[model samples]
Target chain A: MPLAKRIIPCLDIKNGTTVKGINFVELRDAGDPVELAAAYSKQGADELTFLDITATHEGRKTFVQLVERIAAHINIPFTVGGGIHELRDVERLLVAGADKISINSAALRHPELITEIADHFGSQVCVVAIDAREDDNDWHCYLNGGRIPTAHKLFDWAHEAQERGAGEILFTSMNHDGVKQGYALSALRHLHEQLNIPIIASGGAGTKNHFVEAFEQGMADAALAASVFHFGEIPIPELKSYLCEQGIPIRKL
Target chain B: MNIVILKYNAGNIRSVDHALRRLGVEATITDDHDLIRQADKVIFPGVGEAKYTIEYLRNHGLDKLLLELTNPVLGICLGMQLMCSHSEEGDADLLGIFDQKVKKFQSPSTDFKIPHMGWNTLTDTKSPLFEGISDNEFTYFVHSYYVPVCEHTIATTDYIHPFSAALHKDNYYATQFHPEKSAGVGERILKNFLAL
Candidate 1:
């Protein structure tokens, strides 16, 4: 059997608590990050991702403490993002038991950081997340939590990241995010064709069928969603069962 | 039982420590030769490039110390690769406990990624390390290089092809997958190792 398609639940954390909001606004408290991580692991999530939305200096300290707690409680591997500025931050998170570290703006600003991370740690430890939106029939990469648009094209930047030794690419379509529609299939498929590393499809995962589409059509190695898994709209076990029935290779508990 | 995780310059060693803690066993992370030698079980866990790590091991004399230990020793991911005869990653020669050569995954096509990240099933299980685990049970794997099936292979997992997922030779056991991060199945595997 081929490698099972991964189902990852993303926790947008702020001040040590998990939060979910529509389009990154009107935030609502979900629960404690550690408790949610433990529950998701029990539900057989292939991996858990905690993105520190605030990324404040104080929040970074608390986030590190939170990572330690999640590592102590959860047995599955996890990736942590947000406010990872340098090698020291990556080292700290890994030391706190994070299996992988994702970087976005910092990586875009300093492409050398990707090579540094992959060289110091390993390519498997570096995950480059790209937030891009389709503009004039071409996707343009965004930065600073999708507020500032960059001149880097989606495909070109993703390719560069892969060349720079990124293990995986987490591509989130800003247009599809928070819409509950579906992933950016064309872009994801394009990435799958252009890059050799695993591509994680993020944004616009409404139903379980959307996930199936992401895998079958988008060719995504993993599908990441924040609200659908957090709001109890779709339980991970049921989703996995549905994906399995769809002839998708999934890890069934 | 005293569990010492042979710690050199490597990533994700703490995650192994945390996993053992979840199993109610606190493993000490150290490079101390005496502590590792005295432990009932030694876990050689790592996630880094083999070339530099193997060099560090040799410089610290861990390469020879590891060979001398008679206790049950478990190697994870890069630790497993370093136990092989040689690695294609850096063309570096490693400890010859398994006699298998590690080779980088040549993606036959884009369908198979290099890292082989995500969960996959384990088959041909023969070791007590998988005592409570059944065949075709899923485990987490994240690595670019793999040891092909060999005489020492106790378990096999298929990605691009059948490769050595777990190896067993006397007191030394190694797994290409991260059993520490494989959820309940991994926890059971660790418990089985402790029972050994």
Candidate 2:
């Protein structure tokens, strides 16, 4: 049976190492991407997502070496994002052994690229990574690590993405990023209500209960976080047990 | 010897590549047909709907290519389903290499969800695939459709009905569960598959 719910672990890689902090600050090295990914795979993570937060800033694709290393070690489905803007980026990521390529800025600037990726790679292999912010008025979408704002409404962009044949949506709320407050439930719900494919809810993970709430309140198919899992604040297996005790559907190791 | 994983427009190739490496069996991932054909063993895995996947193969004309392979092939989850005769999901047509039909598990009878996610036990173990593995051992699963029990039923698991958990025919074998994501037992299964 297909997984009804997913618990994903995110590793923000900068300078070939995993880093995590609020608003992308106090950047601390977690560990090697391959080592951390292998550990997570052993712990029964349903899937893994890698954000190359420094790839663009570094002006090169850092994923080829890291992704190849991880793929040579960790055996599970994983995604790669950050600095992905063209077919070459997708090609390089795929060549490095990424199961899926996620587009955010590129998807917004040239929506046709979404179709091109979908048409070439199939919708399942192309996931649109959307970073959003709630400005006390209406939800607005952001790209390039929340630097560029898209004029398209959050729900509107999600709908366009689905129409363009995106297999999944990796949504991170800028307002919630690193806050560990919780996922932006309203925006998540808005995207969920609009799209049929799976939605991986990222950012704002403070506690184990946040994962539960991401499912119960946000109705997200998956909940993703970096610090909680990296710091051992919430061991995934124990969290799964608690979720099981709560009757939440989770993939057992 | 290194096992080559054909990385086309499919799903979950990296995990398989990583699993082999963890088992100390060097694995290479590539879409080049020659490398796949030359591999000691081949694995075709997928996570999307079978029809579109089949269409993708048909579009690329790789369906016939996959069916022609003679090496020990292990298909996982969607990869396993695509090797079957047909699929109920999306009314998809499969490669039909295995004499079985992949049918969607309809909970029209009880409260069991359509896509059975999580761990379940495997029984009726027949093939060497479970050589080091135990009976009634649970593995990870994530799918809405499943292959029904047939002559190829090397193992069985009950969701609402006893369904085929694993299948075997000649050198081609498959599992509805993901060995890559199944922890150490999964690694052992991959090792077992490699040994064949």
Candidate 3:
């Protein structure tokens, strides 16, 4: 079975409200998570991902209720990330109806966490959260909500995670994030070619054509964006239709 | 008859339902064996690891039930891998319906990536899935573990090397890629599967 190109809408939630801005800095309230998630589901996004950008170790804490709201209201599979620190977090997310849990800072810190999740939930359900930056020559790893830097390079982490049994890699580029210029195609190609897992390219998606680049040029399994989705700049269904027009072989929605 | 999608503990079903609806097929997701077995077509799709999937299916006894399916059953992406004999991912025994084994595509030292995500072609094979499908045609893929070419290999694609793209044994048919997310060619395959 071939994996289909996915157009995902990222809802950055803060204190139960769905919000989106740029580069994880500007704080603009979009609406209710349930409402936004329902709309995306209706629009034919392959999947919906909710990142609690505000739910940090000190910011708010836990997104059980928010995840439950999205899961209960909408039937589509949505991944929840941010402040996910342990196996318990994975269980809680699953119990709350999150079909997948994405670990950003946590996975980088504790690579074994991926194995624990795979041991319990399965590799497909456990997605490694990679916040990357193309600096100094090679791709660098970022952690602590994309704040702290790690020693191991991205290619290393990617290969390690796959060995550790991560089913998918959700890779976001800090360079193109919030810019809307386009996806970091070079970074995407590196990950897309080197890793055997599905890489969902995040950051720097300005238009429908940007998605095409992510799929066609970048070779990403899926293209992910937050601002464009929150601002209604691009609808999920519209993007998929556009990709179909380009003959990219997306699941018709 | 209405289509029923098995929803045990996998990811990406809603997208499949949405895509099917877009194609004018009504689909309902349920773990209820009675409901699934009665459907005109049953879709069993998922993402993630294999061992836990088998357990999830075993939890609801869906593993055994899926083997008994006589109706047309379509497995997508991870769904296809789980339908095989076994997978290096978690080294778990799969449903064994396809009599094919899953192996790792990448290594700790090898440069080839795992999860093989993106569009590649089905090189050699013929089937209803490829009715209008062509050689050099690309379909999206995202998995590290792949089911090798076997007697059931209906279509094949090369990532690091050629591997099974579509597998069929008896009434069971599966693809290592997501048809729900695949565009026209993928939709054509799904439509063909439904027609089967």
Candidate 4:
């Protein structure tokens, strides 16, 4: 069999805790990131992604400490992102025990930073996250938590990032994000067809079938969702079992 | 037992250190020639460009030290690539422990991605590294280059084609994938290596 399609649970961290308003679960009900990470790892999540949405310096330090605590608890690969601007920031995160670092806004601010990171720490360490939204008809990339827009077309920017040596492209459709209407399959398929690098399909995953479609229809190498996995709408183990039963290769529990 | 993880300018070193800690083993992360030579087992794990790592090894006189070591040595990812005679990555000349060449993974189809990233199962698992591990057990991988199947190949995996997933030559055992990051299967593999 080919490599298993990865099932990733994304944890959105704000000020050292998982942000609330992701479904009915309150911030207190969501539990700690470290405990949640350990739970997900045991529950058969292939990997985990932590997006530190904290903007304050104190929050950033807390996120780093959280990463350290989580890294000590889980054995699977974990990626840390959000507010990572410079190489020093990446160094700090990596030292704090992150397996990979995701760059979004800063990657747009200076395109050369992609090549710089790839050259220093191999392309696999560099993940260029493109948060995109459909505008008029064409998908346009956005930065800064999908608040800022750029003229870079989604497909064109994905190709450029690959050329700049990004090992993987975590393409999140802002239109599909938080809506749980399912992934932007057509756009994901288009990017998967165009790029030679792996595509991590992020945003809008509601059910086990949604993940299956992301792999079979969208040709995504991985499917990433936050609220569904976070709020128990779709447990990762049950989801993987469903995918395995549906003829999609996945790691056995 | 003294276990030393030969540290270079590599990513994933911290993860490897943590994995060892989880296994109740304290591994020394160093590039010191004498320390590496004196260790019972040396783990040559790295995640960086071949040419730059080779230059660092030579400048620090660790290249000669590595070539002379008699202890069981395990290499992971770029570490495994560097153990080969040559690498197409930056056209580097490596440690030449294994008489093979590492080549970049070229996609045969438009959909095929480089780096062969994710979990892949291992077949023909005959080495001690895979003891107690089942055939076709999945392990994590992240690399654009691969060591083609040779007599030294102990396990094989298919991506663009069947390639050496694990190689063993005397005291030198290496994995093209990151076993340290491969979950329980990885921990078992590491335990097997230590048992050697």
Q: What TM-score fits each model?
A: 0.97, 0.78, 0.65, 0.96
**Local accuracy of candidate 1 as per-residue lDDT tens digits, A1-253:** 7899999999988988877742322223336777677778888899999999875789889999999998888989899999988999998998888989999999999999999999888899899999999988999999998999999999999999999999999999999999999999999999998889999999999999999999999999999998988777888999999999999999988
> Which ten contiguous residues of candidate 4 chain A have the minimum total lDDT?
A20-29
User: Which is the winner by TM-score between candidate 1 and candidate 2?
Assistant: 1
Candidate ranking (TM-score, best to worst): 1, 4, 2, 3
Tens-digit per-residue lDDT, B72-120, candidate 3: 9999988999998888878898898888889988554323445565556
**Candidate 2 vs 4: which has more TM-score:** 4
Window of ten residues with lowest summed lDDT in model 3 chain A: A21-30
The reply for model 1, stretches above 4 Å from the true place, is A21-30
Tens-place lDDT digits, model 2, residues B1-196 = 6587766666567667667767777777766777778888988876666777888888776788788888888888888899998888778778888978788676643135334654667788988889977776667676668888999989898877888888988878999988886767777788888888
Q: What number of clashing residue pairs does each candidate have, in the order they appear? A: 0, 5, 30, 0
For residues A137-180, write the lDDT of model 2, one tens digit per residue. Answer: 67788877789887777788888898888878889888888888
User: CA lDDT of A106 in candidate 1?
Assistant: 97
TM-score of chain A of 3: 0.91
Candidates' C-alpha lDDT: 0.91, 0.77, 0.78, 0.89
Q: Alpha-carbon error at A140 in model 4, in Å?
A: 1.4
Model no. 1, DockQ? 0.87
Q: Per-candidate TM-score, first chain only?
A: 0.95, 0.91, 0.91, 0.95
The C-alpha stretches of model 2 lying farther than 4 A from their native spots are: A1-4, A21-30, A55-59, B1-15, B26-72, B77-79, B86-95, B102-127, B131-151, B154-165
Q: On residues B1-196, what C-alpha lDDT tens digit does candidate 1 reach at each position?
A: 8999988998778888888888889888889999999999999988888899999999999999999999999999999999989999889999989888899989988999889998999999998899978889999999889999999999999998999999999999999999889999998998888889
Quote model 4's TM-score: 0.96
Q: Report lDDT (Cα) of residue A227, candidate 2.
A: 80
